[model samples]
Target: MSIYVGNLSYQVTDEDLKQAFAEYGKVKSVQLPTDRETGRPRGFAFVEMETEEQETAAIEALDGAEWMGRDLKVNKAKPREERSPRGSWGGGGRSGGGRGDRRY
Candidate 1:
């Protein structure tokens, strides 16, 4: 299982997250998602530890702790939900049929 860390500073790196959690126990992995359009940090991350005890310890110690100028929100991550594929028009609205008014 992985841990969800929210309210992180944009400047926080994967290494920073790993180091912070390492104090409790072995850190398996750290992932920081980025904005697809701008490629910027999303201010949140996921951390995986070696054992549940380590995870619980990290969560308890860092849940409300201040780090990198922001209060952390740490907890177990929920499973990702499945999403349907987007349409060719980007799935914002109706795909077929135009305005139906054309000048001859």
Candidate 2:
């Protein structure tokens, strides 16, 4: 399971996040995304722990806890939603077709 850590200071690093959660259990991984255009931390991160129990413990301990000069927002990460492929816009919204578009 994963935990979403928000309201993070942009300076927070991978090691810093791992260490903060280490008191609860083993941290499997941390994914800190960056802005595509500016290449800066996005102010949040997703952290995976070795087990669901560990994740829960971390969530309970860290949620609303202050760290690095900010109140941390921690919770179970929501499942990622699937998106339509770029430029394809997915199906079924067009109102009608002109006479020239008739298949017959």
Candidate 3:
């Protein structure tokens, strides 16, 4: 299981996360997603450790701990929910009216 690290500073990087978690144990991987529009860090990350014991230790040590000027929210990541495809207007394409409805 991977750990969900939240309330991170925008400046945080993958290597930074790896280093922080490495103190507890071997860090398997770190994923920090970025905003699609502005192309900036999303202020959160997912850290995968080599073992559950190491993951637990990291979570206990880091949760609510102040780091990078923010209180961290570290826990096991929940399974990502499936989202429906979005349209140009950000809707789920449920609205029927569109360019096809206009007949000049």
Candidate 4:
């Protein structure tokens, strides 16, 4: 459903991405994330297709192909890892400061 596209031109828009993938299959969605402070294109995007076959076709055709003056790095998007709170540990097998329950 999701494909990660890297090394994209900042000038690219969501519609442009959709159109590019349209030849492979129906594009469900396209997301081009931007910088928090600048709101500019982040030079990468996540494209969603209607099916896995369409996704695989897009990956096979677009991966390493030259487009918009850069080679594309297209692949299946991996699920994001769960994140812990800013200062809290998620109990990933590490000692808590190694201080025997001592408090600062």
Candidate 5:
């Protein structure tokens, strides 16, 4: 079961998240999205549990629970949107940096 947790403190680590939810059941994984450049937490994360019961319990118990002085936002994760292939920009094959023929 997948769960969405938001409003996380930037200092929270994956182990902190795991320990928080482990009180209810086994956690499969905890993913905290971070800045690709700075490696800082993005204030949100995805937690996967072993069963729906555990997921529901986590959501109910932690949905508004305070963590690191902030109330966490917990819910079932929504399906992620599909992404286009890399470099396949919808604007007719233009690369990200610039158009070759256009004079800057």
Candidate 6:
């Protein structure tokens, strides 16, 4: 089972997250989202556990709990929506025509 954790402090690290949830159960992985340009933590993360019991435990123990001066939000992660690949210009369009169809 996987969970989405949000409202994190910028200083929060994967180790901190793991330690917090470790008290409840085994954490399979912890992923903190980072800024695309600055590469700094985006103040949210995702945690995955091997069992529903573990997930439930972590959620019950951590949700709305304060950590690093911020309230942590824990809940089941939603499935990622499929996105189209980049540069997928499948639409029919034309551009940069030199004065065509114009009374130049």
List lDDT for all candidates, in order: 0.93, 0.93, 0.95, 0.94, 0.93, 0.90
Q: Candidate 5: misplaced stretches above 4 Å?
A: 85-89, 92-104
Worst 10-residue stretch by lDDT in candidate 5? 92-101
Candidate 3 local lDDT, 1-104, one digit each (tens): 89999999999999999999999999999999999999899999999999999999999999999999999999999999987777645756656887788767
Best by lDDT: 3
| Better candidate by TM-score, 3 or 5 | 3
For every candidate, C-alpha RMSD to the true structure in Å: 4.0, 3.3, 4.5, 4.6, 5.1, 2.9
Q: What TM-score goes with each of the models?
A: 0.82, 0.82, 0.82, 0.81, 0.80, 0.81
Residue-level lDDT of model 6, residues 1-104, one tens digit each, is 58999999999899998998888888899999999999899989999987899999889988999889998888999999999999997765655545575654
Q: What are the runs in model 4 whose C-alpha is more than 4 Å off? A: 87-104
Tens-digit lDDT track for model 2 on 45-76? 99999999999999999999999999999999
For model 6 the TM-score comes to: 0.81
* Residue 10 lDDT, candidate 6, scale 0-100: 94
**lDDT by residue for model 1 over 1-104, one digit each (tens)?**
99999999999899999889999999999999999999889999999999999999999999999999999999999999988677644655755637774447
lDDT of 4 by residue, 25-76 (tens): 9999999999899999999999999999999999999999999999999999
Report backbone clashes per prediction: 0, 0, 0, 0, 0, 0
Error of 6 at 19 (Å): 0.3
Error of 5 at 23 (Å): 0.8
